[model samples]
Target: MRPVLLLLLGAHLAYAGKHSLKYIFTAVSGDIDFPEFTSVGLLDDGQFDYFDSNTMKAVPKTEWIRQNEGADYWTRATQNLIGTHQTFKVSIQTVKERFNHSTGVHTWQLMYGCELDDDGSTRGYHQYGYDGSDFVSLDKSSLTWTAANPQAVITKHKWEATTYAVKEKAYLENTCIEWLKKYVDYGKDTLERKVSPQVSLLQKSSSSPVTCHATGFYPSGVKISWQKNRHDHDEDVDLGETLLNEDGTFQKTSTLGVRPEEWKNNQFSCVVEHQGKTIRKTADDIITNFESVPIGIIVGAVAAVILLLVIGVAGYLVYQRKKGFKPVSGSDDGSNSSAHT
Candidate 1:
């Protein structure tokens, strides 16, 4: 089916390193003075280096460029890029028809190399784009765009972009990914290796969702979910994004909705699956383990009581021994103590 088209594209493929592509579209309406425009790019590091589009060159000349740390790199990248400019003139008669001047710009970027472990496999890729100031994200199976502007304006020519993107993506996978593998063997700076994730539960709040959070994870492939009676439950669960932590680890949160009855009945648990093992923690566990300190205090009190009784018994035995002494005065005969004195 059309569900996944690229996976079926090739039987044998070559490799290539650091190859990519991009595109842009602009449309204007309303004022008699209006125009239509669009563009495409092949980029490095998210910036259009060694190349210039009409918008790229003009936007950065002002504060936007100077404030950008990568200004120098992209501006200089033109030397390595191929660029072209076209001018179209409309006679005075056609000017009245174009008005309102709606402009849209979209760009896509990609970077691919061989997996560090396997030459035949790809290290995967980093591919994303921008629709004007908003963001667009894509993967092997999906393409998405988000913006504050109305969806209508954004989707105006979405089909055109989609068709081009699909073709370009297939081109990269079948041609670019493997071709790069020839020259670009993943030695060190390749894809990140997988690491076992740390899993924890967030505190429960009244009327709020119960969250199971995993932090300091790796590979972005771990799973977190809810369980009832040791059984996994997926219904009514929401998974948040897996974001990178400051320490280069990944973190994500999954929320489970519970009815008032479930909380009162203690019917929920958080379970995390990482590295082929499952760790489960339940709300009832908190209540069962929270009083360990109190158990230690009771043991201490019994020890103190036993020590007091032993001391009292020792004191009584000493008094009895003293009372029995009767101070013998003479060496042998049963002489009176008064005579010896």
Candidate 2:
């Protein structure tokens, strides 16, 4: 009979262990917030029990039970939930409830308490951390969410900078090309052309002596002189000083002061001596039928005055003939006209 009683006691203890292992709090419908705690019944050894929602486990507080009120029932329930070795297994019902309702909630609280780090240190909260509060609501049907990383943002900025640099370089290159094209076009098309030199002469109507100024830019060397009927007289030819410009071009001018008679029936010319060839251009050649004083008009006016005087004398002689008048030498009487008739 004692052996049978011992067998029954062992069987009862084994059944009790199995029932204790299976006993776990199942979370039903409610808003499950993380890192919260609740009090459960005490264990038979009189210890306090606290349920943690973050770890989904129960923990026994033995020292707490000895120091606080309701130690007997609180300690027993805590021991039953935490087990003998102060370790608890997470309930599947709690895990399922947390997983199903974790669509937009913290899911790290579902981990068993034993799985937590023993150092009691938690990683700081960040956008990608497990305890991060910066989570977007997950679409339950699509099971998708959006996130951003700082590395990707930095890469995008670098790409934009590179593109701007390339564009600036291209703009500078195009501007240089345009400038070169303009320079080449100007150099090829713009140059001076040769033209015949122009000449002009001026004189005063009064007795003032004539003045002559000859000015021109001749690429070829030139000679300018005043001549009387193509004869060179002893006169001073005022040759102006030559000037050299920055562009390697030359200019020359000459002047002469002469009496008015010097231009009488005379031609003044500017002769260009270039490359063993002499080209003579005169001011007379430019002015058609140019003469000093118009001698023909003067002679014609004198002849007209003389002819008119002669005609008047002839008419007085004819009138004397018609009146039958005779003239006597040194006679003052009118009777001499009849004696001559």
Candidate 3:
């Protein structure tokens, strides 16, 4: 019992502990625009013109008039500034509250557009108002933006910003958990039922090398290496381009070639690295060695051998006992024979 317990303890210790980081990063971008409002006016005549109801006059296109109106209205109201381009950036930061348990925080930033006027200084108040400042925070829980300073208002702006957390531990933990869930849900069928690594050995008579090809999906980056007798061998490795699937997943292939002798005697391994751990599959002539014999086969073979040996030994013992038995069946019969002699 003690020995068995000790063995189990040793086995547990020998099993590699999970290795993982605290965070994962994913980048995404999208187009954002404020809806056009009705207060802004539209351009009607050909000569860079706009109708201003407040002044009760037809005003020529000017910066002051455009500043009060939105960019979409101003651009459409005048032919001079029509077809202008505006670019903005959006940044999101995921903050975690619990190291590996609870959800945390998220921050957002917006940088409005600004440009230099004819006076060699930044102008265009409509575009310049919100420049170089944090505008809002996107609450992850509510999925809505919270204005940092609600009272601060700007007319025309293009915002670019990023939000991140100080304690990255929570972020990493959540990322790892999410990745694990995704891997299990979508990747389990392919990953759990392990496939033997497809291996092909090519030989070259000249100094030129041969290439071996292998294709597989490994959510965790896999290490494809050439080996000789389970030892790492130096060889040229070429990783081909990975193709993304329609489901937003990716698949890649790796190719490597070694000398003919290396392939003949040594074992080659494709090790999949994931979650700070490695799982390996080796091929000798492209065939997989079973990690363990099937339970039914193993039990049947052992039982048959044991039963046959038992029967054979029992029959041999019976034969030996019969052969050795000598009957002193009659002292009387022996005495009669001696008298007759």
Which structure among the candidates has the greatest lDDT? Answer: 1
User: What is candidate 2's lDDT per residue for 1-341, written digit by digit as tens?
Assistant: 00000000111121111000001122222344322222222121111334533443444433433343344544444444333112112222233343354343322111000000112221101011122111121111232322233322332344334443243223222322232222222222111222222233333443343333222333323454455456664365665433222121233344445544554546665454433444555545332223653443334334433422221222222322322211100000001101000
Displacement of the residue 218 alpha carbon in candidate 3, Å: 5.5
**Deviation (Å) of 151 in candidate 2:** 79
Tens-place lDDT digits, model 1, residues 123-196: 22222212222222224445332222343233324523655445444543554434333212221122233566
Order of quality (TM-score):
1, 3, 2
TM-score of 1: 0.40
Report residue 181 deviation for candidate 2 (angstroms).
23
lDDT of 3 by residue, 288-331 (tens): 22234344333433543342222122221222132211000000
Candidates 2 and 3 compared: the better one by lDDT is 2
- Off-target runs (Cα >4 Å) in candidate 1 are 1-175, 178-184, 187-192, 245-248, 284-341
TM-score of 2: 0.22
Which candidate achieves the best TM-score against the true structure? 1
Model 2 poorest 10 in a row by lDDT? 1-10
User: What's the TM-score of every candidate structure?
Assistant: 0.40, 0.22, 0.24
Instruction: Write down the lDDT that model 2 would get.
Output: 0.27
Better of 1 and 3 by TM-score: 1
**lDDT of all the models against the reference?**
0.35, 0.27, 0.26
lDDT measured at residue 71 in model 1 versus the true structure, 0 to 100: 45
